[model samples]
Target: MAGSQGEGWRPARPAGWRRRMARLPLLMYRAGLGPLFGNRLLVLHHTGRVSGLDRTVVLEVVALDREVPAWTLASGFGPTADWYRNLKESPRTTIQVGSHRVPVTAHFLSAEEGGRIMARYAPRHPRVARRLCAFMGFEVDGSEDSFRRAGERIPFVRLVRSPAPGPAAG
Candidate 1:
């Protein structure tokens, strides 16, 4: 509801119940309920920047490239989100999509790329795109240009799967 009124709206970091609710997906994933969400959502396992402890966050998969084995995600809460920052410090991490855990390397996409991705995503998931843009303080008119502009303002990252380690030499 933060951006319901549109421009100049910036959502505050979630706290208390909201924070707990946001984290519920992580618990579900750990409980082996990940398949329920399918490939739409993924659990990102990362290291805390300051604490050096393991951390996990569930994020929606905005795009998926089976060929590259990559998943693109947007920072709904903006770049200040802990998970986003953590990836910056340590790009090497893992993600769980359904029952599969994949080793991946985070690659931040440029604004232009984000715009194109958003433009493509909007038509595929119109309602979600609208709501997501609104939640992120962007006013999208359902036009490709509007969605592209909104996407430009959002930070996106692509997690490309790392190749399996080769067998060790005897």
Candidate 2:
């Protein structure tokens, strides 16, 4: 009953122990333990839209085109997520994945584009795609079409890196 449309599948913000536990990986990354899985995950640093303070979050890379030094990420918590909003307020930011750290800009992708990305992604990483779908409240039947549908409902962003570290957009 996860991906039935409406608000049945919306992700709620984590709190208490859940919030603290979810931050463990970010802590590890700060402690120099990021390289272990940096190829697949990244630590994003954005300025809070309201607080004007720096914030960080770990996001799984949905797609990575190293040729362009760009990475795609999905907002499982929807477009209103804190980090997503933060990035919108300041598109210029930094991300660290493994040993690769770069200044990047966040570009929001249309749902159709997201669907296409997911379609291509599912074939390459079926297990991860399935898990992602489930986590996003998408109850897919393990089919590419279903996965694509789920992607259409999720907001996606493309992080494009600059040639050099740039000044903050804020």
Candidate 3:
């Protein structure tokens, strides 16, 4: 397994799959995964700081220690990536995994902490890692190296898990 501590990576997809994925349009590329993977894609809802309205986007989440925390990217693929920039401005967020929706806040990790998380969570796809590395501009050693450098361009949000609300004790 390519990982450490809370994060890790799975094996890479075959070349045939890569070609098929590359052929997909951006919107289709993002949506196709929903049906194919179902309940696996996480939907992130955030209020646009300027618009003051909610914007929703889908992201692939890396689940760390089950009950501990989850990690997601803001802009590792590109500094101009819109979804990531939005989250950076407004940390307040709602996350949907499967049918469950939970309210949480995003906290951007420092470069060092992000490197630590990346050491564990880097994915195996070289294409993906390469794209991330391009944005981060760091020397890549392996998936972990790419993951750590990916933080350079992308903001890392540590989901601030909140306690579930309950009935007030009378």
Local distance difference test scores for all models:
0.86, 0.84, 0.54
Q: Write the per-residue lDDT of candidate 1 for residues 45-116, one digit (tens) a residue.
A: 888889988887899999999998899999987888898998899888888899988888889999999999
- Which wins on TM-score, candidate 2 or candidate 3? 2
Sorted on TM-score, highest at the top, how do the candidates line up? 1, 2, 3
lDDT of 2 at 46: 86
How would you encode candidate 2's per-residue C-alpha lDDT over 1-170 as one tens digit per residue?
A: 35555664466778999999889889889888999885788898888888888778999898999899899998878888898988888888888888667899999999899999989988999998888788777888878888889889888999999765634432
TM-score of every candidate relative to the true structure: 0.88, 0.88, 0.60
Candidate 1 regions off by >4 Å? 1-10, 164-170
Count of backbone clashes, every candidate in sequence: 0, 1, 3
Pairwise lDDT winner, candidates 1 and 3: 1
Top candidate on lDDT is 1
Off by over 4 Å in 2: 1-9, 164-170
Cα deviation in Å at residue 45, candidate 1?
0.5
Cα lDDT, model 3, residue 93: 67
lDDT for model 1 = 0.86
Off by over 4 Å in 3: 1-40, 77-81, 123-127, 135-147, 150-153, 164-170
For every candidate, C-alpha RMSD to the true structure in Å: 4.7, 2.5, 9.8
